[model samples]
Target: MNVVITPHTLQGTVEAPSSKSIGHRDLICAALADGESVVDNISPSQDIEATCQILQAFGADIQEIPSSHPGRAAYCVRGGLKRQDQPLSVNANESGSTLRFLIPVGILSGNTVTFHGQGRLAKRPLAPYYTIFDEKHIAYTTTDGALPLTVHGTLRPGRYALAGDVSSQFFTGLLMTLPLLSGDSHLQSTTPLESASYVNMTIDCLTQHGIQIDKDWNGSYHIPGNQQYRNGEYVVEGDYSQAAFWLSAGTLGKAICCTGLRPHSSQGDEVIVSIIRQMGGQIEGKTELTACPSLLEGRVIDVEDCPDLVPVLTVLATCSKGITRIINAGRVRLKECDRLHAIATELNKLGADVEEEPEGLIIHGVSGLTGGRVSGWNDHRIAMALAVASQRCSGTLVIEGAECVRKSYPEFWQDFASLGGIYRQED
Candidate 1:
C-alpha cells in the first residue's frame, strides 16, 4: 500500500504498542514452559506471529484470549517443541529476530527444519549461527545465504565462541538452546560485544522463565544443563523503538504523550528518550513518556547500543539546528533493508540533507524538509520513520509500501490518525 500524507500539526495521545522485543522472548518462553503460561498485554504483529506460529507448528498449544489491556491480546501457551521424524518448515516473514531465535530451537528439537524468509530477509546474513553449526558438526545447507536453509543433527552443549560485533540475535539463539542441553555450556564472545543490552534482555527473559544464566566479568555467558521453563504470567511492556517515531513527531509538531512504557526498561532502544532530550526536545516522564515541540540542537548520537533508533533519529537530526552525526552503526546494513542507506536515500529524496557513511549517518539540520514521494524500502522502521518525518515536510509526502508497518506495529497507521495525521491510502 502507498500512503500520501499532507503535512499537518500532530498532537494528542497514542498508547505505545507492546514491545516486540519482549513479546518475542515472552511468547517463546511461555510456549516452552513446562505448563500453561499466560503472555498478557501482547499484540500480534507479523513478526511476533511468525515466531508464535512456528512454535505452534513445533507442538506448542497457543490460544489467543482477551488481553489485560484494550487494543491487545493474550496468549495461553502450553506444551513445548517436539521432535518429529520428518522435517519442520518455518517461515520467518522477513523478521530477522524470529529467524535467528528459532534456528537453535529447531536443532535442539531434533528435527530437520527448513527455515524460509520473505523480502530482504533471505539476504540477511546468518553467518554467526553458521559458525556454531560448523564447530558443532551440525549439517546445514543454504542457497548462497538465501532462505530455505535446512539444518540437521542435534545440538550438544559445550564451549562456544561467537563474534560479539556481528548480530546479538545469534547469541540469543544459542543462549536459549544451551540451557536445554544435557551438559553445561559456555558461550564466549570473541570480540567486544556491541548491542550487549539485547543479550541482557535475552538473559532477563530466561531468568523470568525460571532458568539461570551466569555472566562473567569478561562478558561471557555460562549456562547449566537440564533446565526447565516454568510457566507463569508475563506482561509485555510498550515498545521503546516504536515510541521513537511518535516522540520524534512530537518534537517536530505538537505535544504527544505515550503511555505503557516500562520505566528503566532493559530495552536498549529506550535510549531514544534520552536522545530526543539531548537534542533539546521537551520530553519527560517514566511510566508515560511525553514529547513536546522544541527547537532541537544537533548533537553527536551513538548507534553502538541502539542501531534501531538511527532512522527516526536521523529524521530528528534533519530538523535539528546544526550538524547531527550518528556514528557506530554498520550493522544497520544487515537489517530488513540497509537502514543507513535507506534512511539517507529516502530523506534526501525529500530534500533533507542526509549523508550515508560507511558506519553511520551525518545529517545537516535544515529549517524544514521539502517533501515528495519516497519508497518505504520494505522495512518497517524505514517506513515509520518516514511517516514521522512527514510532519516536518513542507509538501505532501507519499510513502510507498507504507503497509510494511504491520511487521512490528500493526496499528501504527490508526495511531498515526489518532495523532491527527492526515493521510490517504492507495492500492
Candidate 2:
C-alpha cells in the first residue's frame, strides 16, 4: 500500500499503543499460569497474534474481549501449556520474539517440534539456543542457521551460559522454562548484557505469575525450580517505542499529547523521553507524555540498550540543529531490518543527510526535508519512522508499503488520523 501524506501539522491528543514487548511477556506467562489470567490493554498486531496462536496450540483457551479503544482488546487466557501426543509444529510468522520466547517451552517435552518462520526471521540467529541444545544433549537440525529448524530433546535443570549481546529474548525463554524444572538453575552471561531492561521486564512478569528468579549485581540469574505459575490480572502498559514517533512529530510541529503511558517504565525505550528533552524538544506531563514544537539541537545518542528507538530517534535527529551521532546500534542491524541502513537510506531520499556507519549513524541535520518518495523497507518501524519524518517535510511525502505498521501497531494509522494527521490513500 502507498500512502501520500501531505506535509501538515499534526494536532490533538492520541492514546499510545499498548507495549508489544510487555504484551508478549505477560501473555506467555498467562498461558503458563495455573488458572485463568486476564491481560488487558492489548492492541492487535501481527507479532502479538503469532504469540497468541502459538499459545492456543499449547492448550491455552484465549478469548478476546472487545474494547472501545480502536485497536485495544483484552485477552482472557485459560488452560496451560500441555505436552501433546503428536509433534508440535509452530509457524512463528515474522515475529522474532515469538520464535525465541517459545523455543525452550516447545522442546521441554522431548516431542519433536519444528519452527517455521518467514521473511527476515529465517535470517535471525538462533545460535544461542542451539548452543544450549548441544550442552543439554538436545537433538536439533537447522537449515544452515535459517528457519524450519527441528528440535527433539528434553531441557533439564542445569546452569546455562550464553552470550547476552545477541538478544535478551533467549534469556527470557530460559528464565521462563527453568523454574518448571525439578531442580534449581543458574544462568550466567558470557558477555556484557545488552537490552538488560527487557530481561528485567521478564523477571517482573514471572514474579507476577508467582515464579521467583533471583539476580545478582553481576547479572547472573538464579531461577528456582518446581515453581507454579499463578496468574490473576495484568494490565499491559503503553508502548514508548511506538510513542516515540508521535513525540518526535510534536517536536517538529504542533503540541501532541500522548496518553496511556506509564511513568518510570522498565521498558528501555522510555529513554526516548529523555532523548527528546536533551535534544531541546518541548516536553511536559509525566502521566500524559506531551511534546511541543521547539528548536531541536543535535546531541549524542547511545542505543546500546534501547535499539528499537533508533529509527524514530533518527527522525528526530534529522531536524535538530547540530550533528547527531547515534552509536552502539549494531544490534539494530538484526532487527526487522537493518535500521541503521534503512533509516539512513529512506530519510536521505527525503533530502535528509544521514551517513550510515558500520555500527551507527552520523546525521547532519538540515533545516527541513524536501520530501519526495520513500520506501518503508517492508519494516514496521521504518514505515512509522518515515511517517513521523513527514511532518517536517516541505512537499507531499509518499511512502510505499505503509501497511507494515500492522506488525506492532495495527492502529497506528488510525491513531495518526485521530491526531489530525493529514494523509490519504494512494495507488
Candidate 3:
C-alpha cells in the first residue's frame, strides 16, 4: 500500500500497544505448561499470529477472547507440545522470535521437524543453533545458516556455550528449552551479551510460569532440569518500541500523550524516553507520558541493546540540532531490513542528511526536512518512522509499502489518523 502525508502536527492521546516481546515469551511458556493458561492484553499482529499458529500446530489449543478495548485480546492456551510420528512442518512466516524460540522446543518432540520461513527470515542467521546442534551431535540440515531447516536428534542438556553478540533470541530459545531437559544445563556466554534486557524479559516470563533460572553478572545462566511450567494468567505490558514513534512525534510536532506504558518495564527500548530527553525533548507524567516538543539537540547514542530504536531515532535525530551518532548498531542490518541503510536511504530522499556506517549511522540534524517519496523497505519500523518524520516535512511525503506496519501495528494507520495526522491511502 502507498500513503501520502501532508504537513500536520500530531495531537491527542494514544494508548501504547501491548508488548510483542513479552507476549511471545508468555505464550510460549503458557504452551509449555501442563494446563490451560490465559494471557491478557495481547494485540494480534502478524508476528504474534505466527507464534500462535506454530504452537497450535504443536498441539496447544489457543483461543482468542475478544476484549472491550480495541486492538487487544486475551488468549487461552491449552498447554503441552504434542509429539508426532512423522516429520512435523511449521511455518514461521516472517517472525524471527517464533522461528528461533520454537526450534529447540521442536527437538523435544523426538521426531523430525522442518521449519519454514518467509521473506528475510529465511536469510537471517541461525548459526547459534547450529553450534548447539554440532556440540550435541544432533542431526540437522539447513540452507546454509538460513531457514527451511530440518532437525531430528534429541537435544541433550549440558553446558551450552553461545556468543553473546549473536541475536538474543538464540539465548532465549535455549533458556526456554533447557529447563525441560532431564539433566541440569548451563548456558555460558562467550562474550558480553548485547540486548541483555530481552533475556531478562525471557527470565521474567519463565519465572512467572514456575521455572527458575540462575544468572550471574558474568553472563552465565543455570537452568535446573526436569522443571515444569505452572499454568496461570499473565498480562503483557505496553510496548515501548511502538510508543517511541509517538514520543518522537511529540518532539517533532504537538505534545503526544501516550498511555498504558509501564515506566519500570524491562523492555530495553524503554530507553527511548531517556534518549529523547538527552536530545533535549521534554517528557512529563507517570503512567501516561506526555512528550512535548523542545529544542532537540543531537547526541551520541549506543544502540547495542536497543537496535529496534534505530529507525525512529534516526527520524528524531533528523529534526534535532547538531550531529547524532548511533553506534553499535551493526546487528540491525540483519533485521527485517538493513535498517541503518534503509533509514539513511529512505530518509535522505526527504532531504535529511544521514550517512550510513558499517556498524551505525551519523545523522546531521536539519531545522526541517523537504518532503519527497520514500520506500518503507517493507519494514514496519521504517514505515512508521517515515510517517512520524512527515510531521516536519515542508511538503507532502509519499511512502510506498506503508501497509508493512501491519506486521507489528495493525492499527498504526488508524492511530496515526486519530492523532490528527493528515494522510490518505493510495493504490
Model 1 CA lDDT for position 217:
86
lDDT of 1 at 363: 91
RMSD of 1: 1.1
Task: Report clash pairs, candidate 1.
Answer: none
Residue-level lDDT of model 2, residues 341-364, one tens digit each, is 999999998889999989899999
**Per-candidate clashes, comma-separated:** 0, 0, 0
Consecutive 10-residue window with the lowest summed lDDT within model 1: 79-88
lDDT of 3 by residue, 1-427 (tens): 8998988999999999999999999999999999998999987799999999888878789999866557798999999887776678889988999999998888875768899998999999998889889989999998777779999888788899988897999999999989999999999988889999999989988988899999966769999999999999888999999999999998789999999999888899999999998888999987799999789999899999999999999999999899999999999999999999999998888889999889999999987889899999999999999999999899999999999998899999999999999899875
Model 3 vs. true fold: TM = 0.98
Candidate 1 lDDT tens digits, 1-427: 9999999988999888999998998988887777899999987799999998899877799999898799898999995888876788889989989999988888877789899999988888888788888988999999886788999888887899988898899999888888988889999999989999999999988998898999988889889989998898999988899999998899899999999988888899999988888888889788888899999999999889999998999999999999999999899998988999999999998888998889988899988788798999989999999999988899999999999999999899999999999999964
Total colliding residue pairs, candidate 2: 0
Ranking by lDDT: 3, 1, 2
| All candidates: TM-score | 0.98, 0.98, 0.98
RMSD per candidate (Å) reads 1.1, 1.2, 1.0
lDDT of each: 0.90, 0.89, 0.91
Q: Which ten residues in a row have the lowest lDDT in candidate 3?
A: 65-74
